[model samples]
Target: MTPDHPKSRRSFSDFLLHLHPRTIPEENLRLTLSWGLGGMAVMLVCLLFLTGILLLLTYQPSTGSAYASIVTLTREVRFGLWIRNIHHWSANLLVVIAMLHLLRIVLTGAFGQGRRLNWIIGLFLLFLLLSANFTGYLLPWDQLAYWAVTICTSMLGYIPVGGLWLQELFRGGAEIGPATLSNFCVLHVAFIPATLFVLLLWHFWLVRRAGGLVQVEHDNPDDVPVQRVPTVPNLIVREAAVGLVLVAFILILAIVWDAPLMEQANPGMSPNPAKAPWYFLGFQELLLHLHPVFASFLWPLLGVAALLWVPFWQDSALPTGVWFGSNSGRRLVIWTATVGALTTLAIILADNLLLQSNAAVAVDTLVTRGLLPTALLIALLVGFYFLLVKGLKYTRAEAVMAGIVLVLVALAVCTIIGVWFRGAEMHLVWL
Candidate 1:
């Protein structure tokens, strides 16, 4: 109202410019530094740096001598066991902790409003994490590592047009051989790491520009004002705490239990029941139960398409002032979850029963060679989609549905682990 006031004029300009002022609360910022993802990310990056340095000293990424070099490192090099342990554990921890950090962001609802791009970056980070882990898995040169890569590459056959080519690229040949191992090792230790480093730097730069986590929705200034702390000091403390704990634990595990090394890979011998890594075994399971069109192509395609459409599920055809939950939006989420869980349970039970039945017992000549298992896998994935779409009409809570679906998926995973453990005990190699 004061037309001539300097402060009033500046305030008007600020409003017109769409600017908002925020005072940095030192205590709040300091606390953010203490526990936020910034600390976690720094710890993971540090682990990568230290362990990667150690790995570079001994790792020989070549087709002819890579496995032999690893053997030499374990048997001959000084403290080489520790170095390998650090590299293995650091890679595993990086992925696990990064997921945790992403979950923290999601639970805190920090992905809403202007932070959508941050969420996208986090998703890309997850993809990179998986790529990094997958590449690393191929480096150990054990049976588990070798055939696991083979099984995974084979899954690309489900891709529509270029699946075969993609699979070849992964193998670096028409089949899994020394070239595949060497190529993967290079990507793991060299190329992927370089890209990861660049992306990580970009991610942090974005974080800095965006500022840290938004205040929790439940926080009330009248109740207790939040605190803000500077990034440097708090990072030094909290990251040291988490990083040291993780590193020490891995060191102890490595010292006590050497990583499993199955017999040197032999492409000529197909073991009784070869399996991929656990993360991919579920997918491998899918290949058992359906036709290629249903198993490899349509199912994965649809699953991903469903995930992409999630944000739009409750929205109308055109943007409107109506709220997302004005109708049965939340109810729909619950029904989706309920249906997914039920279908997964059915498919898993069916698979286990079939595997243990007389049909599996007989193990006819051709079927035993691996076609039966592959067909069973295709069936499983198709069955999963069939059951998932069954409960679209229910009314329930989103959280409840998500929890139920999670439980079902976990149960199926546990079942697979049980099967693997039994096979492992029998010394029956399957991969």
Candidate 2:
């Protein structure tokens, strides 16, 4: 048969459909459900891969030549700056999309039942995405990259037992140098990308196996059967449209705003208020108010542990596929978010005031600065849980959700402050 024949077209369509289910629930097609964040992530990853290959053609991943090579590429090579900008912006956008996808899964109770493993896989993918971005950040070999990475690696040293070892492992020495550049280049271009690709495939397969996107349940037996649509034309077309829009958006952004590149890496000089990447700025903000061990190691570890525990703690009675699990869950989120933001801002302001006054000297020790703050956070969370369960009559699942939302709100507030408000000497300065 000729390429344009019906038989040929049908066979080609079948080939495309093989990657997806022949029929998917109509609910899965709703953009409002998943917000197409997962599809956007996949599209961003594809963009990153394409732009990264273009970049690798000229990028010199070495302490001696990296910055000069990037400058030459940006100024001399055809479309080199645009390609680099796309890659840079796409990588950052992937981080945000991955996080939002994860949050969607949690809030909608998509991790319930057999999907727990997929949830864990999603978490790992997020971690790998962050790793990819972090390693790539050092590839530019500019002063901004150098000191930002130095600050982040230094945080790793705050871990109790293997902290210093881990820091040295990544830094390739006691500090960021030639060896560190080489190590990051390899991980960024080869190891991390390869691992992330494999995990992404596994994540997709698991989601398909779990029966597509989760859907709202029907309690009445007489309810009409749920609608279904073919994946080849329906789902694929929607995805393609979304992908094109995302590409257009990123391309416009790439043209409008060039990716930042500062002076060459200088060991002799450090930028005052040298900060970590925007993603890690939340932790950097935390470090200002708490002990390094608590801010850098313990609290982060606990947060991850809490996320991992979410699936197991999920209440079976809570309906899956509904936003916030129920109306109670929605109310809990609203209340938690308001209280959490106010409390976080209050604490930051109070702490800053104390630091500016003689009172800070009295609270400078580990107990007052570290353990006390840690205990207070725990107390607040526990207290909030009880209040929700007892006073508000929320279910256990809703209470867990409240805690998660509160923590997210607090982190967001901290990140915003770190990125925009903090100025010289890490002092809070309204911009």
Candidate 3:
């Protein structure tokens, strides 16, 4: 066991080899199974780190010079704009890919059989990924970044208690200022990335320990022997191919689309319809129709809690490792999505009409805008759940899947409205 012994002197490749099992199920190699999302996500994170470091070479975090530095980086430095574009696009794409990866896990029941810890870790990773994006959003010190951050931080004050304290903690005072930018820079560059790196390592290790991706369970397990392939060439080759394609796609996108940069921040002159980042647009859209507490605090909290609860809700009737749990589950998803979208549209239209006609003014704001909508949403979900379970004879798991899909569809619709439909004074505009 001497330090210089051949056995002790493992190469970098050897270390990497040890990170994965000697053999993994051959089925895991199928691209359609996992959709290569997890691998794509890993590639995106690597790109983010690489490009972020390059951008840091010129990015000035100070309020006075941040915007100017960005301008110089994009216009003056060689390949600076491309690097920034890659970082921007990669961050946004990572958010999306991470979410889809989570959804794949849920639909395939990959979180079952003592994998709950990894599921929780995955959820935290998603949250941290979002935090990373939010912190980075402010570094340019542009109007878009400043007001968007302001609106998001202001929403924090809607919490039941200690809301103002939380708001100040993020804002660094009563408003977005010098301290806020410095704090976010430290978080984005030092704390958040460091934490994400550690968590990502842990996540990968857990996946490896769990014997790679979950395989589809056959009805008669003993009838056929499970086939496994060596991890070195089989899994590694597929991963390498995916990484190459992903890198090429990202580079092309970065070249084609430059990251947006608005004028330097002028806090005194807010935009006509200042909005949060697109991810949070669902919440902003909710605020327009509901009370702040429900939109900003309660509904989001509930959604997250439901996600956290997913792994614990076990049903023997539902098959594991199958898309949407079963054929019936797939139909449930379709029905839920269609009904959810139409219902959301109807509600929005009705609410808009009420406001325009001044009919909503007669009721208390809390009742008309907050409690009623919240109660209605709950009732609809609960009623739909029962209908699926009792009337349709679906398993509880399928019912839960329906509920989640419905809520997600509603949120997606709201986000679309917020991003494309909202105009001056946050009013709905067809264009």
- Please provide, for model 1 over 257-300, each residue's C-alpha lDDT reduced to its tens digit, 9 standing for 90 to 100: 66556766667665556776655555555555444545456655
| Runs off by more than 4 Å, candidate 1 | 1-38, 218-226, 292-298, 302-346, 354-431
Q: What's the true lDDT of residue 214 in model 1?
A: 53
Ordered from best to worst TM-score, the candidate numbers read 2, 3, 1
TM-score of each: 0.69, 0.96, 0.95
Off by over 4 Å in 3: 1-12, 316-318, 359-364
Per-residue lDDT for 284 in model 3? 94
Specify the poorest-scoring 10-residue window by lDDT in model 2: 357-366
Among these predicted structures, which one has the highest TM-score?
2
Better of 1 and 3 by TM-score: 3
Give the root-mean-square deviation of each candidate in angstroms.
Answer: 10.2, 1.8, 3.1
Task: Using lDDT, rank the candidates from best to worst.
Answer: 2, 3, 1
By TM-score, how accurate is candidate 2?
0.96
lDDT of 3 by residue, 197-304 (tens): 999999999988888888878879898778988887788889989989989998999999999999999999998899999999989988887888888998999899
Steric overlap count per candidate: 29, 0, 0
